[model samples]
Structures are given as C-alpha cells and as structure tokens.
Target: MKPLVILLAAAAAFGADPPAREKLPTSRADLENGEKLYQANCGLCHGTKGDGGRGAVLAGRKLSRAADDAALVKVIEEGVRGTEMPGAWQLSARESRQVAAFVRSLSRVSSKPVPGDPSRGAELYARNHCSACHTIRGLGGSAGPDLSDTGLRRNPAFLRTSLTDPEAELPRSYQLVSIRSNSGSTITGARLSEDSFSIQVGDSSGKVHSFWKHEISELKKERGKSAMPSYKQLSSADLDDLVAYLSSLKEAS
Candidate 1:
C-alpha cells in the first residue's frame, strides 16, 4: 500500500477528537464562572439573587421556555423571539453553557411531595365556591388573580402561606381597595390597575368599578389586605386536598 493510504487507514482506526458531549465541563469551577457571568450580564434584570425584578423570576419557579440544560444553553446563546430577553452576544459558547448550568442550579425541587388527592381536591374546590372570585383555567371569576399557572410560579410553601394568611404578601395589583362614592355607597374590591387620575377595581361581585379621582369622595388603598378570605377554618385534610389540587394546576395542563 502507498504511504498516504497507510496514513489514511491509521487515521480511520482512531478518532481525532473526543465526542461533543464529552467536551462539556461540569465542575464547581464552571458553575462559579457561570455565576459570575450571570451576575454581570443577567442580574440587573433577573435580580441579584434571581428572585426577579424587571425580568421574570428565575429562582424557585418553573421555566417553560428552557426546561433543561441544553434548551437553556440555546436560549442564552439565542434570545427568545418577540421578547425583551436579549441573546448573550458577549459570551462564548463555553460561557453560555456555564450560564445554563448556573441557571439550572436555581431550580428548587420540593422535598415534601404534594400530600393530598387531586381528584378530591377538585371536588372540594368546587364545594368551597372558589370560582366566585378566583379563576382557574379561565373557568372562574376575574375578580382575583388567575391561578391557571399557579403551580408553575409558586411553590408548595408559598401556596400554603397564601391559603392560611391571604394578606401576608400583597402584590400591587391585588391590594384591597375601599372606595366610597359621593352617594355614600361603598364598594370594596381588589385593585387591578391605577394611574394618577383613575383607578380600576374588581369588586367582590366580579364587577369592575372604574372611578376617577374627582368622582369618589374617599379612596382607600389598604396594603396587606386581600379580598380572598383565609381558609384556616377548613379541616386540615380538606385544606391539604385543596392545596394539592391547586398545585397540580400548570399552564400546559
């Protein structure tokens, strides 16, 4: 055989490079490097601790767009279309992979599994008339926050806190409002939106009441109050069942 042919045969017998998957470095150092990159590049919008600010919450929440490491790497390298999230142009391929690993580290897998029958919880949810104010998959009233994706956004502990103490953490949108009109009629509801001149409220009856600043005699916006009452009165098993049912709710399901 020719010398060139022998060389070709030898080259074919052994690979020149390792497989692509083998090149991926998963070490403590890599994760630390990724954290530095994430803090420098993404922390401003995603919050220093990844709790969220101008951008969506990253920690302890379900990430629909990039559910896995590979997908996250792609998203970090190439931004999501039609969204404010921009691609990381400054990062190299390795740096992008590092960032994805760091992001995956933020996922909080629940130690205690959801501890009730979802089917029974659904029955209890209906029995409790929860649909009167809150919405579940667009089937309930619009007065309260839509809980179609509650399972995705909130953890089990947070859900439990919300159920036991409804007023513990009040988002600006859900702050309780009491408006007394010129006719002495009082309307209490959760504030939906507000501006300098007008405020929109969704009352207990699922009716939106829009009032101009000049029209209402008194406008009371009380923080740490929710239209939804506490469910501490319910039996422990019932509450657990309800929570389980709620926890089962996801945007996809």
Candidate 2:
C-alpha cells in the first residue's frame, strides 16, 4: 500500500483516544489537529517542524529516550527527567497523544547533516584534555557534568554555543562559590551541596572540601560563570569537529 494509505489507517486506529501500546495512525483530521497543536505548543524550542532550536533535533534520527509510539507519548506527557523538557501539564492524555504523533512524524523529515567527522572529533576531545574536567563513559573527572550521554541530552547548537560562550546557559546546578573563613582565607570551587550547618565544595584540583558555616565568614554563590574556558579561538573546522564528537556521545544501542 501507499504511504498515504498507511497513514490514514493509523489515524482511523487512533479514533479519539487509543491505548499507549497501539501504534500511531493519522487520519486527515487527526494530522491537521496534531500539527496545529504541535506548532502552537512545541514550536518555541522544538521548532514548528521539529527541526529543533534549543531542544534535541527530532528529524531523521533514532530517538534514544523515545523508542516507540508509546514511549513518545509517555515522554510527551511525563517529560524527560533531569533535562529542560517539561511535561505537558496543560495538555490531557489525548492532546499529548496528538503532539506525540506529530513529533514522531517529524522523524521522516530531512535533518541537516551533522557538521564534522566523529572520529576526528574524538581525537580532538582527548587532545584538548576535555576529560580533565568532564566525565565521559565513567572514565573521566567529575568537576563538570558527566557527559557520557551528552548526545542524547543536548543538540549540536547548544554544544557549539557552550563551547564558544561558556557563560551562556550554564547548568542550573552550576554553582561556583567563594567561601571566606574566619581567618580571612578563601576557597573557591563548585558547590557540591549545602545544608543549614555546612556545605561541600569541589576545588579546582577535584578535591572535595567540607566546611562548617560557623567557620565561614562569608559564602558567595557565583552565577553565569563557568569554570569551563571558552573555545572561541579554535578554528571553525576544529570547533565543528569538537561539536560533532560531543554530539556523537549517545547511549549504547
């Protein structure tokens, strides 16, 4: 049968509300409704066509978090935990289903080619000693966020922007702090955690230091400042290669 017929069959199967276990089917009405909903609700970050802006690129790639139609629906309603994607709190299950179907269809759209070679990017990552601060595949340091599955989490645009402008969109958890002791000495590092009585910090050398509030004269939490240096000086090709490498760090198939 033709693709159009297949789509219509799926749409008829959906009716009004279908079980999560069922596959997607789009009647003409359903397709138009889904597209309208998606454009209105998801166009800001995901783009009207799901080409992506700040969110993950949804076209022409195997979605690691959403493996099937049911999975996509679940993600739409519940959201991906620990990431910027939020749950469809304003949308009901049926509306969420509509959005999920639209998003899934975006996979058939053509995606822009990823700019550089992954192999070259991998070599660049090691040469630049990126593992000194960032952890990947459980083998690197932890001063920064673990990037073992960065490809699954962030898009290339975000990655490239972060490289050239480290101060932009620092992780919400990022808290580089300066703590001054009663003795007038100071220590600066990433804040691991803080409680009413004490706080933990990871210093530049990756040594975690614990201190009591009583001993600290002042504690200042810095924002919009990343310990990561900007890579603006890198050549365009080098930058592209680096971004490609970072984008390729997906979860195991």
Candidate 3:
C-alpha cells in the first residue's frame, strides 16, 4: 500500500488526527501552558482574567453555550455557528483540551464582591423600564439579549460598562437596522434575522416585518450603535446598586 494510504489506515484504527475531544489536561505544566494560550488568544475579548469584555465572561458563572469540558473544546475548535465567537482553528486537539480545562478552572477563581444593594437595584431596573427591552428570568422583551444569565455570563464591571456605554460593545445580533421597501415605506427596528434572500425586522411594538431582497430599496445596518440608551446619568450609588442587581441574575434555565 502507498505510504499515505498506510497513514490513513493507522489514523482510522486509532482516532482522527486532532480528534474532536481531548482528555481534560489537569497537570500543572498543562494548565500553565493553557493559561498562556488563553491569555494570548482569548484574553483580549474574554478579559485577561476571564472577567469578560467583548466576549462572555468565563469566570464564576456557568457558561451556557459551552456547558461542559467537551462542549467547550468543540466551541474552541469549531466555534459557535452564528455568534461572534470564531473557532480556534489554530489550536491542536491537545491544546484545545488544555484551554478547555483552564476555562473550567476559571469558574473557581473568587470574584470580587458586588458592592451595593440588589433590592435597590431591582427597583431601579423597574423604575427605568429596563424590562421594556431586556429580559430577566422568563419575563420581559425579546428585542434585547436575554439577561437571564447576564450575571453569570458577565461580571459586574462588564454590566456597568454595558449600562454606561452600550454602544461600546453593541452585540451584532441586536443592532438596530433600518429597511425601506420599494413602496416608499420605511421600518426601523431590531433585525430579527437576515439571509441571502429575505430579512426580518421587529418593530418596537413587537410587530415583525419581512421583506425580500428585491423588495428592499434600502437596507442599512447601524453598526456600533444600540437602540438602548445609556444609563450614565444614573447616580454613582444607583449605578453600583444596578450593577449589583444585574450581577445577581445567574439563572439561565
């Protein structure tokens, strides 16, 4: 048999090269290498300490999408299909598993205590009509990203930045989009979905508008923008309390 054929046969007999999963690396050297790898590739978005920034937080709270070690490895290697997270195609299977193990260990790192009163923050949330756009538990609007696990997915610092400067890290999925039909009608709302041929938008009134590409005379996505206004006007105490309240939301189910 040809050498290449022999190699393929050997790989099949054992396992695929760079297999989908790797055993969780728990050794000190492996974890150290994993930390270095994570810092280089993931720290920019997930934060140097996994406190979270452009990406979801990795520490203290449960990771919804990458729920387990194997799942985390898959996410790192293949990426989440639709979201901003791209695959770490550069990492080998062994390296990916090491990274996964490091990520799992981050949850045990003690997070700084959230200062302020959660009860007061809850009141502030209602007073500001936050639920009109965001959701908590099983209630509220779908226009914005679900906050059922924001506390877990994001740290208090991230929550504060989101409140103060929403445009800084406007989630691409929830950016405000405008669509104008050939009929001279315009609809500006949250973009529900987009595809090669059709686009869907949801107005503030929760009305969904669908249009074909041919029917759309003008379609513009407002990048680096958010429909949610900034809450920077809130007093320092209020901000602290609100951060506390948002950081308290850990329920993802």
Candidate 4:
C-alpha cells in the first residue's frame, strides 16, 4: 500500500477525519479521564503538560504519527523496561485506551529537530562520560550497545529516554545480572563490561564493579534494564539541547 493510504487508514482507525485532521474521541469524558490519568501517573516524569522532565517529553512529539492506539496501549501497559517508567497493567483496558488517547493528543503538533548541533552534542557526550559505557564511532566502552547508528534505529523519544531513564527500556542482548554471594549476599545490576574471565556490572546506584568469573558462586542472568539514570537535575533547555545533539548522529546517507 502507498504510504499516504497507510496514514489515512491509521487516521481512520483512530476515528480521525483525514480532511479535518481532528481526532474524534468516543466521548469528551474519555479525554478528560485521559488527562487526569496522565496527570496522576505520568506528570512527574513527563511533566504536567508532557514537556518532559525526569521523563522524556511527550508534548509535540511525533510518536502518534508512527504508532497507532494499539501500540500506544502496549507501551503504557507493558511499560518500557530498563527505564524509570514502570509497567501500568493495573489500569483497566478502557483506562489504558484513555491514557493512550491523552498521549496521542500531545502529538497534535510535530517536534522536529532544527538541524541538530552534532558538535555541541559531542561535547555533552564527553562531559557526561556517556562513552564510559556506550560506544560511538568505534570509540568508547563496550558496556552498552554501539550507538553509531542509533539515530536511524531509534526515535527522538527513545533517545531522550536513553539519557534520562535507560533501565526502562531493555535491549535484547544486555541481560540483567543477579549475583548471590557465598555469604548469602545478593546484588542485582546490568552487565557493563564482560569477557570470558571477568565481568563488570553497574548497579542502580550508578556504581560499576568488576568480578572474576570464579568469584561469583551464584550468578543469575535475567532480562537486564538500561543502566542510564534520570536527569532530574537538568533544566528543560539542557535536555532539549542534549537530545538535539544525540539525534544528529545518524550514519551518512
């Protein structure tokens, strides 16, 4: 099918009139309920108006254009593992749909980058020591996945989350590690740097530790979350600037 037809079909499925470009909710009550749900559950991280804070900004995001209601509902219910956002399966299906509606409402306006400043982002990357764990351009640590082509693979929303709450979104290969010592001590963290003889782990505290394979008597590997932390201290402008920087690092066409 043509891309235009697919878009129209998606719009129609969401009760949106293509020519009007207006989303028709089942009822006003649903919209209101969605707003309230967003406030109570998503406000702190995403901000009251979804401008982002401890969480990635949702306002003016283009996610709705890429994802439909069903996808949105899944994200809300399952939550993005390896980040600060937790699963919200407790919400009823109706409520989940309502929240999805609210999130979609935030995307009414598009938020494209104004030609990102890769140089500025490069400085930010170094200052933040992102290279300590993640690799970029074949230079950096091996703890996280190579980000050389992240611009193509991930959207801006996902990139923002990568900065703020990495653990919320878990990648496929990076498994979570739970280590129980012979003394009955336990530790849980994501693998940062690992090899055949030794493994390095980063805990929730942002502290990284290395251990030889023989040292861990009871090592359990589970689905690991992203080891990134929330940037609660960063101003909104700074967050946007950093996002701009990271989003610009796309592979050459």
lDDT for each of the candidates?
Answer: 0.77, 0.79, 0.84, 0.70
Over 1-253, each residue of candidate 4 has an lDDT whose tens digit, in order, gives 6999999888788785443332336578998999999899988667677755556557675553236666677778888776566778778878877888888888775555634466777777778787776767877766566777565445566677766776676664566788876667777777766788888776655467788877878888875444555675766666676777776665532
Give lDDT tens digits, candidate 2, residues 65-183.
88888888878888888778888888877778777777778888877767998899999888888787787888776667788777755678888988999788676665789999999
TM-score of every candidate: 0.67, 0.80, 0.78, 0.50
Superposed by TM-score, candidate 4 places the C-alpha of residue 206 at a distance from the truth, in angstroms, of 14
**lDDT per residue as tens, model 3, 121-197:** 99999999888767788788766778887886677777898999888776778779888899999998888788999
TM-score of model 3 relative to the true fold?
Answer: 0.78
- Provide C-alpha RMSD values for all models, in order: 9.9, 9.1, 4.5, 10.9
Ranked candidates, highest TM-score first: 2, 3, 1, 4
The runs of at least 3 residues in candidate 4 whose Cα sits more than 4 Å from the true structure, single-residue gaps closed, are: 1-26, 64-66, 81-84, 110-117, 123-132, 137-139, 143-210, 213-244, 247-253
lDDT of 2: 0.79
TM-score for candidate 4, please give it.
Answer: 0.50
Which candidate, 1 or 3, has the higher TM-score? 3
- Model 2, residue 23: C-alpha shift (Å): 5.0
Model 2 misplaced stretches (Cα beyond 4 Å): 1-20, 23-25, 47-54
Worst 10 residues of 4 by lDDT: 16-25
Candidate 2 global TM-score: 0.80
